[model samples]
Target: MSSTWMTTRAWLLMLPLLAIMIAVIGWPMADTVRLSFTDAKLVGLGGRFVGFDNYVKMLTSGNFQRALYATTWFAVVSVTAEMVIGVLAALLLNQRFYGRAVLRALLILPWALPTVVNATLWRLIYNPEYGALNAALTQIGLLDSYRSWLGEPGTAMTALILADCWKNFPLVALIALAALQAVPRDITSAALVDGAGPFARFRFVVLPYLAGPLMVALVLRTIEAFKVFDIIWVMTRGGPANSTRTLSILVYQEAFSFQRAGSGASLALVVTLIVTVLAVGYGLLVRRAAGSAA
Candidate 1:
């Protein structure tokens, strides 16, 4: 077949998908961009164009600043913890054991659960009254009484972080485990014969194999963490003085809860911009890592 004909046939096959994407994603995105520049409300006619007023206001607001800080903190801490715990879990599971298969299957449960379901489960576990966590801590002499895990500013963010990590670490573990499988047994055996310690084996022998996959996991988790919403919403609703308010939550409140569609759209766009920059930055890092590995 001619190259031009092949190209034409491919485009013809993709036409339906392209049209659906334009209708579903492209139109909404364009509408949102238009809405961001207006003074629109959730229940009114199209508001007048405000020409960056919404963006300027949102960008300068104290609430935006606080939300940004909370989001960054959550993303950094949760992703970091997930990566560490996941790699450790992957390493452990990589070893031959009697029930390694069972453990590996069970490791997927947390990641497999729906986010809302996981959040609800964690909420009950952290419940101040008759919650598993409080009961366990009290029995262990760790606490004098039950404490509200999601109710206080001091502990709300930390509690959210812990829940987020639990739900996400399994994904990282799975990725790492898959990468670990690709490492040649002979290479690992040679490293062991060379008298390398466990840490040295991982660092010099196994790590180079794991690096690329782990970077991919890192990028995925970081982006998800940055835009975290449903879990936090179901758990804390950004409550206890908005202590757990992330960028996504802030956007939700601004757009839906407060009925300021224009401002909310602007905030959402800002968030999209931030996420885009992060994705682009991570893409560069991943490329660099791949280049170095090559």
Candidate 2:
């Protein structure tokens, strides 16, 4: 009887959390799935089951295809660039020097800023008229005339990538820097004593230690970058000719602007699926890298 009472107490203890999960996550997920199969809209009370029509329509849309390509490109280029810059910054910061403490704190300022604010700041910087970038370029005679960075199709994504790198590389640097701290200094010193050049030392000793955390950072940044929305929205809003349209923007346009909740829900679920696959792939890679490093 005492054991039964103890078991009941444990059940009671779990009840609140179980209820919270059901209310917070599970309920919304269930609603989204259900909505994806219907013709729901923002103003509609009842929706008829359409049975994959939304998915079919979305898959057939050329605009959706463009968005997918843009999203993939953004995720790949931005994340790769950030990883490279971040890893280098981390290595530099790891070395002792004057003002290193102040610089370390400064590095985080960009990442600590609000994403929307970052986006807006970049938008101003890229503005064709009366922007600092244009003025500086003109003063240095780099450009004959001011160019609208975000307006041009060729430069829009590139501009966004640069801004994203500035905002996000700091976080990656922090992660890589932490990982670098765990590396054995003795190994690096030993390599230096063995006449290894800086390149060789990093290639052989430092990289081996960083492999696991680098993979972890890469996977995480990739996932985050893949679903990026707000920055682009605040800056370009997927812009002049839809060149910067990404999957997340597609969801926003369909759900909110187009008043098609079913399609929006479907698009969101698609994104969730893609992110899930990425997460699983990262998990496997992390385990393999960890095992190899160990």
Candidate 3:
């Protein structure tokens, strides 16, 4: 009877959380899924059952294809750059140095800043006239004149990727640093004593410890980058002939701009499904890596 009472108490404690999740997450997700199958309009409630028409339309749309390509490219480039740069920064900072703590704190400022603020700051820096980027390039003889960075189709996505890397690399660095802190110093020392060079030591001794954290960071950064919208909205607004428009922006434009709620809902579900699959794959890989390490 006492055991039964404890079990009941545990369930009672969980009830509120369960209720909140159902109300906030379950209900909306169900509604969105339902809407995705119908001819829903932003202005009306009487949506007829379309039965995958919206999905077919989205699949066939060239604009949707472009958005998917752009989003994929952005996520791939930004995450890869951030991972490489962040790992390097973490390794450098892990070494003994003067003012290390101050430098670490300073590095976090970019990540800690609000996304909109970071986007706006980069927008200013990329401005054609009196912008830091143009001025620097000119000063270094890289450019003959100040030119619009975000106003050109070719350079717009690249500029956004740079801005995103600046704001996000610190997160990866922090995660990597924490992993580095947990590494067995004794093993590293033994590797050094074995005449292992810096690269060999990092490869044989340090890399095993870093794999798990780096994978976690990669998964997180991939998901965030896939759904990136706010910064692009603030900085480029998916302009330069929609060269930088991503899936999130496409969904927004469909729902709000074109008033095609059904199409937007379908696209949103598609995005969610893609992210979920990618995350699950990463999760499985992490589990396998952990098992192998063990």
Top candidate, metric TM-score: 1
Candidate 2 residues 1-294, lDDT tens each? 699999999999999999999999999999999999999996768689999998999889998889999999999999999999999999999999999999999999999999999999999999989777888998999988999999999999999989999999998899889988987879978998999998998889889888888898899899998899999999999986998989999899999999899989999999899999999999999999999988
| Clash totals for all candidate models | 0, 0, 0
Q: Candidate 2: misplaced stretches above 4 Å?
A: 1-8
How many clashes (backbone atoms < 3 Å, residues ≥3 apart in a chain or on different chains) does model 2 have? 0
Clashing pairs in 2: none
Give per-residue CA lDDT, model 1, range 197-280, as digits (tens).
999999999999999999999999999999999999999999899999999999999999999999999999999999999999
TM-score of the candidate numbered 1? 0.97
Best by lDDT: 1
- How many Å off is the CA of 289 in candidate 2? 1.4
User: Worst lDDT window (10 residues) for model 1?
Assistant: 285-294
What is the TM-score of each predicted model, taking all chains together? 0.97, 0.95, 0.96
Residue-level error in angstroms, candidate 2, position 31: 1.2
| Local distance difference test scores for all models | 0.96, 0.92, 0.95
lDDT of 3 at 251: 93
What's model 2's overall lDDT? 0.92
